[model samples]
Target: MKIGIIGGGSIGLLFSCYLSENHQVTLYCRTINQVNMINQCGITLQKKDSSILSNIHAKLSTERVADELVLVTVKQYHLPELLPILDKIPQHIPLLFLQNGMGHLDYLQKMKHDNILLGVVEHGALKISLSTVKHTGFGTTRVAAYKGDMQKLMAIKNTLQMSNFPFEIEANYNEMLIRKLVVNAAINPLTALLRIKNGDLLSNNYYFELLKEVFQEIIQVLCLQELEDTYFASIVSICQSTSNNYSSMLKDILEHRQTEIEGIVGVLRNKAEIQKQSVPFLQFLYTSIKGMEYKRWDE
Candidate 1:
C-alpha cells in the first residue's frame, strides 16, 4: 500500500515510521529543511529502549498527492490551506483526517471526495527533531467512514494495522470524534495553563477539581448528559494512561508555537454561543491560551 502523510509533525512522522514498515510512505513536509533532512537521513522512531530509522520519500506539501491513501495529519488550523491541495487528489483515492476536535467535521462536510474517513490518534507522539519522533504512549487509531464505504475503510485498516501500531474500525464518526473532543477540551487547556503533566490533572486534588469543572462545562455544551460518566471516566483513564506525557497544547506553548485551542475548545465556545449558554471556563481557557500565543508572537 502506498500512503501519503500530509503533515511532517509528530503524528505524521510517527505514522510514517510505523506505516513505512509494511507499506510505501511519502511524507509531505511543510519545510524544505525537513524534507532534505528526512530524504538524506531517513526518519528515526524512538522508543523506550530502541530506535529505528525508516526511509520514506519526502516532498514539500505543494507537490501533488498521488498515493493509494492519504492521511491528513496537519493540525486543525492548518487544514483550511490544505483543502485546495486535497481537492486536487483523484476522487477515487481515500483521504483520512487524523486531527483533534470536532470542528474539522464542518470542513469535511464541504469536501468533494468520494471516500472520506475520520480518525482519532490516541498514541502519545512527540517530535524530537525534524526527522525523529518519540512514541511516548502506545494507543490505537480509531477510524470511521464519514462518507465512504465501510469495506473500503476495513480494507485500509487491515493493511495499515501492525503489531506496534494498531487501527480499529468505528461505526459512527460523530460518536468517535466527540469522545476525543471531550478528552481534548477537558484536559488540554488546564494542563497547558498549569504547566503540568497529564497525570498531574488527576494526582493533584485541586487540579482534579478544575478538571471536573471544565469537564462539566464541556459536556453541558455538547449535551452529553446521559453518558457523562462514561466520557468523564475516559478522560481520567487517558490521563492515567499517558501520565507522564505532556499534551500537544502544552508542548506548543512551551515551544512558542501556535496551539490548536481554536480547533478544540473554540468549537465548543462557538457551539455554546449558538446554544445561548454560558461557558465561563471554556471562555477563560480560550482567551488565556490565545493571550499566551499572542505574547509569544509579540515578544
Candidate 2:
C-alpha cells in the first residue's frame, strides 16, 4: 500500500512515520523547506524515552499525489486551500480526512471523491521541528466510512494499523465525529482561554464545574439523549488520560495562529439557533476565541 499524507504538522509526521513502516508513504508539506528536510534526513519521531528515524518520500503539496490512500491531516481552516488540489486527484482514490471539527463535513460532501473516510485521531502529537514530531500520548484512531465501501475501508485500516498504533472501524460517521466534537467542545476552548494543561481542568473544582456545564450545553444543543452519561464520562476520561498535553487549540492561541472554533463551537451555535435554543456558554466561548484571534490580528 502507498500512503500519501497531506500535512506537515504533527499528525501528518506521526502518520507518515508509522505508516512508512509497513507501506510506502509520501508526506506532502506546504513548504519546500520541510520537504527538503524530510527527504534529506527522514522523519524523527519521539515518544517518552525513545526516538526512531524513518526514511520516507516527501514532496510539496503543489506536486501531484499518486498514492493508493491519501490522508488529509490538515486543519479545518486549511481545507479551502486544499480543496482545489484534492479536486485534481482521481475520484476513485480513497481520501481520509482527519479534521477536528464538524464544519468540514458539508464541504467534504461536495467533493468529487466517491470513497471518503472520516477519522478521529485520539493520539497527542507535537511537532518539534520541520521533520520531527513528539508523540506525547497514545490512543486509538476510530474511522468511519462516509462514502466508501466497507471492504475498501477494512483493507485501508488493515494496511495502516500496527501493534503500537491501533485502529477501529466505527459504524456511523456522524456519531463518531459528534462524540469527538463533544469532547472538543467541553475541553479545548476552556484550556485555550485559561492557558492551562488538560489536567488543570480536572485538578481545579471550579474549572471542572465549568467543563460539566459546557458539556451539558453541547448535549442540549445536539439533543444527544440516553448517551449523555456515557459522553460525559468520556470527556472526563480524556482529560485525565491526556493530562499533561496542551490541546491543539491552546497551541494555536499560544502561537498566534487561527483555530477551528467555527468548526467546533460555531457548528453547535448554528444548530442551536436553528432549533431556537439558547446556549449562552457556547456563545461565550465562541466569542472569546474569536476575540483572541482578532486581537492577534490587530497586533
Instruction: Provide the clash count, candidate 2.
Output: 0
Looking at model 1, residue 76 earns an lDDT score of 89
Report, for every candidate in turn, its global Cα lDDT versus the true structure: 0.94, 0.93
List runs of model 2 lying over 4 Å from the truth: none
Residues 108-163 of candidate 2: C-alpha lDDT, one tens digit per residue = 87898889999999888999999999998888899999997999999888888898
Instruction: Pick the lDDT winner.
Output: 1
Taking all chains together, each candidate's TM-score versus the true structure is: 0.98, 0.98
Clash list (residue pairs), candidate 2 = none
Q: What is the lDDT of candidate 1?
A: 0.94
User: Model 2's lDDT to the true fold?
Assistant: 0.93
Runs in model 1 deviating more than 4 A are: none
